[model samples]
Target: MNRLSLVAVAAAVFALPALPAAAQSNEITIGISISTTGPAAALGVPERNALDFVPKEIAGVPLKVIVLDDGGDPTNATTNARRFVTESKADVILGSSTTPPTIAVSNVASEAGIPHLALAPFPLTPERAKWSVVLPQPVPIMGKVIYEHMKAHNVKTVGYIGYSDSYGDLWFNDFKKQAEPMALTLVDEERFARPDTSVAGQVLKLVAANPDAVLVGASGTAAALPQTSLRDRGYKGLIYQTHGAASMDFIRIAGPAAEGVIMASGPVMNPEGQADSALTKKPGLALDTAYEAKYGPNTRSQFAGHSYDAFEVLKRVIPVALKTAKPGTPEFREAIRQAFMSEHEIAATQGVYNWTEKDRSGLDDRSRILLTVKNGKYVPAM
Candidate 1:
């Protein structure tokens, strides 16, 4: 329908970043704003790369996809969303690899009444939750699994060190929510900026507390800082990481410190390790294989799986929405939104989704899988 398939600063599956976006009257435009640089690059780069694999068209309609780099900043994310809405007239949006930026994109999408498939576990607010369906398994759900694993392993007290941002707060709150009722003491809490080179000061505080385990509530390669620092400080406690750290970069960056570190993650992290009967297993394996084939072995990121699943969601719902309204119209966008709420038991690479008008992340317990770094690779913790 249009000469270009995407508009961004980088080469894309369909179009180049140097071109202007397709003039209004989209057949079906999907705008993606992700952190392909800055702190969350580990998550966003894979997510952006996975877009290369999405079908050229869905449901007999040519789709125009536009991607933008937010660099993990909320302000940049917001500007990207505005560009999507004002320039591309995007019917749907996805993006911002980290929580704060994801929320920022969600807010912009909500204002424009576009359906947003968020890639981060952003806080659910009444207004934004209505228009946004998150791709990641919620923090509370992942936290419960980690806390249960902790309790089962006889962990009585915990310490926390994470980003000084909304994502870290979301994880830390879940840590407290699970720990307080379970009678697990929180020994210490520390925070660091995403771009900071050293978390040595925070590591010193956490090591001094010497809790039975320490949970690092950060994502991407930045999440590796605390783990490496804590081990350097000679902290002997078990280390736990949020799903945001469920990536190969953590192992690559943390090196030996990543060993014995456990994380609550999606089935996609180690798809072959999952039971064959699981609905997510096949799709997860497919994405992992495709990504590894293109990017190389052990390169699949859970963030990419989330991006893969967002396309899966569109595949299932676009046909349904087409029956109600033509693409490129607000009515069609609303139809897509309603179509998502109507569908349940969605089997995607990351998890089974069942989003509603009221809920954000529609993932169930089946979405959660535990993994630990073993011999420089991720393995089932169980």
Candidate 2:
């Protein structure tokens, strides 16, 4: 009787229907690598702040976020991406606040077949296209906006000072393409590293060129170095920056030098008083309202808005992915990749995302606005 009863109990236990995969695997891991500690901290800190708004769960699936600081280092970002895939078992990766680090992590994500959404602007290439998407408007689109403004102001010659990195190169190339179309000649081009304490030498050269305007193509607080130097030297032509510098850190660091400076930015920077028909106005205002409520009055950064949009992309795609596979599995990761590729007309804080297999940025002219630093705040340049 004991043997028969024991055998029957064991059989019954084994025969019970296995728990549904979703119930068994109810958590999704998202890995975030940002430059919270280093040169890009001004940009990364706000991005980290925006994560507070990401819901802990979606479609009853618990979300586990693991954030690592890459310190704006490409090597560190690569290591973080690998660790997230191999150790944290992250289904997707987001981060590395600036372009170079984001690009670095993209390689790791592609190798691991994990979907990556970068908050920084990225030039989508064929190799990385399989696994990556970015939140910020592409360089060319934002470049055109700046050049159009320059033409309106009757600026025909420009000088450039940019970071000695891919971010700077991309901006310069894109801006050059636009500048040529508008008959603007770039009189001088100079470069500086992010950690450089001074761009005075480069600024001197740029000012000596006596161009009608100057464009600083660096990001985060570093971009302020050139602007401050230019102002201190009393070179008062026009000064422009890339959208990469659209953070409060740039304003605070540049101080009075930042005033009257013009740049291109996502509409989220100044949502109020926007035309009702503006595509980004409604979503931008919503994000601004939520962000300011949490961080206090007027603390929203366009950099932070990019991170918010990354979450919005996840919100739209992850649910669809869950239908096919459970998280923490290769299939789930691939599902996310496919979902991101096929997404269309998704409105977020920055702009409407309409992605396709070939276009990872999913943003257009509607995504950008021209802004000027006025009274320690960003105002519409139009």
Candidate 3:
């Protein structure tokens, strides 16, 4: 079975919610488990900061976030999920930036009947069942968007390479599905592992196919390999990296070769000085700007915008849930879920939030940012 197609089908099927009865009140407790200290630690640190900013009030009630570290391990995530649900007595759970941990914790959240608002982008499942809510932009939609851009530009033959894992396979399969509808051809497909130094052979293979562009879908230290490979082989095709490869590390790794490469990503930094868009004028734009400054320029990605949006969505629902239903009760969970669904036209820092049974993630073509690296600096691609 095609995993990507299954994801699309399942996401559609699981979109409906089962509303709970009556309200129970008091303090609403939420649990957050993220990789705060590990290889993927940088990804969650900013997310933790964003979740920390969620206020305890919607209608003058206190909402508290209890954080637990899973250290980027699935085992640890399961352990922490149980601890948070049992010891913390949380009504809801949020986080696990990476997919493995998110999947592990999601099982626990579902069996426990505790509502979970997740930031991981892996396709939703029945195991996530009734108590789960997805926060990040799902990759299947991202693939469609990328294919649109490619087709609009008359790009047909394309190269594909990604990490060898569940997450990578998830993204790649979707990219292929969308490409078929758009008349795009997958000329080459490659895979790599963590800490791999050379993808030069993969680059050489893809270049042999004479692809019009290349899509990179790996993150962290592994992101460097392909960029370096493209450069070493001197392939002149247009480069279209995924948001994962849009890191500052790519520029540092590939140096001059990284320039003029186009990629689809979520809002990383405000385009204040570039084109003066509405996001630049947004009141919360300063938060992202401050985040870049605090974390150093190298630590920015679509995940930051995504995780920030996750926290923001929770923040918006907490108060409404508290006022309408009692905390720690099934009614409270239903209220929060209803509040999120009822947000007809949500104005957010990332983009508008308009989720439904069809699409759990509100981000569409508008929320994505097209980026290019010029002289080791990331700037908007127009």
Shift in Å, residue 308, candidate 2: 1.1
Clashing pairs in 2: none
Point out where model 2 deviates above 4 Å: 1-24, 277-279
Off by over 4 Å in 1: 1-4, 9-26
TM-score of each: 0.94, 0.91, 0.82
Candidate 3, residue 349: how far the Cα is off, in Å = 2.5
Task: Report the C-alpha lDDT of model 2 over 20-46, residue by residue, as the tens digit.
Answer: 233224688888888888889889889
After TM-score superposition, the amount by which residue 102's alpha carbon in candidate 3 deviates from its true location, in angstroms, is 2.2
| Residue 277, model 1, lDDT | 90
Q: How good is model 3 by TM-score? A: 0.82
Q: Rate the local accuracy (lDDT) of all candidates.
A: 0.87, 0.83, 0.67
List candidate 3 stretches off by more than 4 Å.
Answer: 1-26, 56-58, 126-129, 152-154, 195-201, 249-254, 271-284, 296-300
Say what the RMSD of model 2 is: 9.5
- Rate residue 300 of model 1 by lDDT: 88
For model 3, what is the error of residue 134's alpha carbon versus the real structure, in angstroms, after optimal superposition? 2.6
Best by lDDT: 1
